[model samples]
Target: MPGLGVCLALAASAAAPPVFVPVERFTLAWTHSIEKVRWEEDYAVVASPTAGQPPVLQARTARVRGSGAGMEPPDDAVLRNGWYEYTPRMGSPQGLRLTRSPYTADYAWCVDGQCVPLGQWLPSDGGVTLLTPCARPPAPER
Candidate 1:
């Protein structure tokens, strides 16, 4: 019986598939006037809502993940959680770089990093309103 148990354990181990952990995905969104920028860990997209106008200047960052079925992040993007709050990562940058393209566009932004002087391009009227990191939606109760 002991030998039979040993054989069963070996078979189970052989049949088990290796585990592959997915990378954590993060996203940051920034808007200035009609210009909007969405940055993910791996890629960045900038769009000018009005023709001829460039994307906005001010920016904000958030931790974003998929909310519905069939929704997928870009090929370079990951899909993980944990963007609500921040703690400095010892010698690293204050916050994670949210966009792939850092400074080329005004909307490119970072989150939870050390405070910096606001750019002249950012609108003064509303200014920048940082978003509170939000909780991931609960899975539908089946």
Candidate 2:
């Protein structure tokens, strides 16, 4: 992916200057507050369809345990070990906005089988966090 120089930009509502994570691919994982089911979505950084646009997140796969409420698994999704796995219809999004709450566990930013609380990188303070693909490495935080 030469010329991509891509990274994931994590910007909290209050974090004027976002902290970036250098990754070509990663997963955003979390557990349901009520159902306690694990949900994970894998994403890859790829060149945008437009000729000169920055890279965008191509959602690769999505998996979750159990289905109810807003967690219904697609009919084509396969079930194994109580987990439903399938490729997401999401082609690419300009960005993803996650609502951070103090009650539930923080979202997990997983890479290379390592999962870390996103709070470790940027403090959301019960605010919203935006994730998007960046064309540059993050600048050193002040």
Candidate 3:
């Protein structure tokens, strides 16, 4: 019976699929004028509306298991404005969704309707961070 149990354990281990865990997801939104930036730590967040224009910026980040294959850590550009979709090793048919991207750098300042390039600007710490509001897909023109 002990031998049978061991066999069963091995079989289960072999059959077990992979699993994925999300590190975190953050989102930042800025108005077209780029006057102010709003941040959301998780999904389904509603930011207080600020005076600005349309064309807000959106960013997302996620840690995936099998999906990370061949994909390198998100780059600055990706961290700045990339939509991430992660797939786990095993479990549900639909994997977790880190709908929002975390701020990569620690500091974010706007000037003349543009986010200063990374490195050029500095947050309290050297850490990276993101800034913006929730993003919606472009609407179909009438």
Kindly give the stretch of ten consecutive residues in candidate 1 with the minimal lDDT sum: 1-10
In the range 4-110, model 3's lDDT, one tens digit per residue, is: 00000111233532221111232222221222233321222232244442222223223312113344333431333443333222321111221212344332223
- TM-scores vs. true structure, each candidate: 0.19, 0.83, 0.17
Candidate 2 residues 31-111, lDDT tens each? 999888899999888777788678888889999988878879888899988889999887787778888899999999888
Q: Give the Å shift of residue 26 in candidate 2.
A: 0.4
Model number with the top TM-score: 2
Between prediction 1 and prediction 2, which has the larger TM-score?
A: 2
Candidate 1 — which residues are off by over 4 angstroms? 1-72, 82-112, 115-142
Of candidates 3 and 2, the better by TM-score:
2
Which stretch of 10 consecutive residues in model 3 shows the poorest summed lDDT? 1-10
What's the lDDT for candidate 1?
A: 0.27
lDDT of 1 by residue, 1-142 (tens): 0000000011123353222111122233443222332323221223334564322222222233332233333344434553232222222221222221223343432334422222321222222222212122234599
The candidate scoring highest on lDDT is: 2
Q: Rank the candidates by lDDT, best first.
A: 2, 1, 3
Higher-ranked by lDDT: 2 or 3: 2
**lDDT for position 90 in model 2:** 70
